[model samples]
Target: MFGEDSPEFSLRIFGDIGMHGDSKSDHSKANFSFGSLDFVISGSMGERLTFFSESLIEGEHADAIFFDQERAWVAWNEGDSFYLQLGMDNSVISRWNRLYNHGRWLETTITRPFLATFEDQGGVLPMHFQGLEIGGLLAPAAGDLEWVAIIANGRGADIEDRQRVHDDNTSKSFSTSLTFTPSSMEALTFGAAALTDIIPADLNSAVRNGSISEQIYDAYFTWLGEQLEWIGEYAWVIHHDGVSGSNFSHRLIYLQMAMPLDDWTPYTRFDLKVMDQNDPYFVPVDQDLDQWQQLLGVRHELTASSAIKLEIGFGHGQDRDAGGAVSSDDFISAALQISWTF
Candidate 1:
């Protein structure tokens, strides 16, 4: 990220597009596509405040595209100790969601772990919330308390396997995260997160109360070295009445490592996501504790502003509608992507 010193209006135009194919059982699949076109407009109001609006038009299929206002927010700095933001922006719920946005070139892997994509992209969790975030820093250097508190319209109603629009219920959600940097080792930080929201109850059954709540707990560790970076996170979701038939509980975890060697960097990650067999949230598709994938990739920087990445993933999982036996979409996949920005 960069800015002009003039404190006046500034605009930047950038985009990422790529194409790839996968060979499975001697058959090739072509998924040539465009990633995103972004327009960022930013400026400042004198000294203590600044604002930016980022608009994105993204590729969804071979011949289809969609436009979304992913970020349109303002930041007000209350000295070096506190900050406030409002409007449509990143929820900052996790390390990955905070470190990356629509910019694919900033990511080490061509595809995000299945768990981190935005809600519409089949992600199991909501990566965005419309509301406010207040955060602060107690100490400047590592080894202090850095925290965020979120109060937002949790998520919209689940319709056709997707969460859309505003909150389906009148109630909002409250969440928080706290990270402690050990004074002894500034490069390492450990964090804990907790959140709660309401989801529609199963139509087939009813809880003693009308509201069904979902609770989430997460923990993460990070280490940043001279040429290497390591990050690991784990989260669990529990609901008292997720499905019409029963309650739900699910867990997900991922560990990522990257080493930059000059213009060439090699990276790898392990991803796993699963739900208890009786997880009601996955009732639409009978869920099981059997979905996992591992990925390995390498990225080559073509220039200061361009990069090419290649990766392969292999995994297996099954989801059956209603209640059925295991039938799956299991395979090994490969992809090559090119990303650039300016």
Candidate 2:
């Protein structure tokens, strides 16, 4: 799909093969499986607005139609100093494996963080939302500074109807982030964000009191070096519910370095994640978990419009013997991915 007369679109298909010598989950041995296919389509309306939609279809059902996200909006570009986008769209609040660019830079074989997904993990949080977003270049500080603000239906796209505007009091939520790029280092960018909402326990009714939520502080810095890219972030969440409390914090660090030699770019990564359990609002888990992963990836550019990527990873978890662990000793996986645009 290329244009409005034809339907502009893109696709990404991937598969993973792995051999495991562990004592954990089922299918611990060698296995081969398709990951997911990302399909997207867009159509332009004159020079001011556009319609865009994207979806993730997995396995044999890849041909099936399951709407993941669809947004139609109008945008105005009044010179280079400012731009405005208005309509139902994805939230511009935080950065995670899925929210930030696409799914290409992940160093792990599986996918992304469990908490960063759109699924329900004991009814905690939803991944995406419907809202009005406006962001653009703010000024020329030492180099460049960008600003973004969003005010949307506090409820995520998946649970929009479940939100009670009157009783829940979480009918709306707002978020914003400011990014700065120093003139000295063109490859480095840093930013901060804040989010607040009136969350609900379930979709029973629209009004659920005392279910409000807040995430006070979050910031990150990314550096794209000559032969490397590094990213680090930290966040703290506080809830009114006593059981859930005062300080719930998390820290994440990921570094990816690649060397370009001819048609191939070989890369490796190191990631560390920690969550504090001593805070008053700490959510206890079945086990205290820490994960270490090592990955080796090769990217082959077949053409200007398409490329292939092969990646392998070795993952290890801390204190595997004491408590029941998800993966036993260690796990390894290999994946082949193809991406293209039209």
Most accurate candidate by TM-score: 1
Scored against the true structure, residue 4 in model 1 reaches a CA lDDT of 38
Candidate 1 weakest ten by summed lDDT: 156-165
Model 2's TM-score against the true structure: 0.69
Overall lDDT per candidate, in order of appearance: 0.73, 0.51
- Give the Å shift of residue 213 in candidate 2: 1.8
Return the clash pairs for model 1, or none.
Answer: 143-181
Q: List the residue pairs that clash in candidate 2.
A: 164-206, 167-207, 168-207, 168-208, 245-281
What tens-digit string does per-residue lDDT give for candidate 2 at 1-342?
A: 435444333344322222223333444344344544454555555454556655555442223334333344556655455667766555444455224423432332233433343332221233455566677785565888887777766753223342323334436777787888899899888888777765544344233212535454567677767666565555444545433334445554445566766657776766554544433222233222445567777777667555577777777654433344333356565656665444
Q: Give me the displacement of residue 222 in model 2, in angstroms.
A: 2.8
Off by over 4 Å in 2: 1-24, 59-67, 70-72, 95-127, 155-169, 203-212, 239-247, 276-290, 318-333
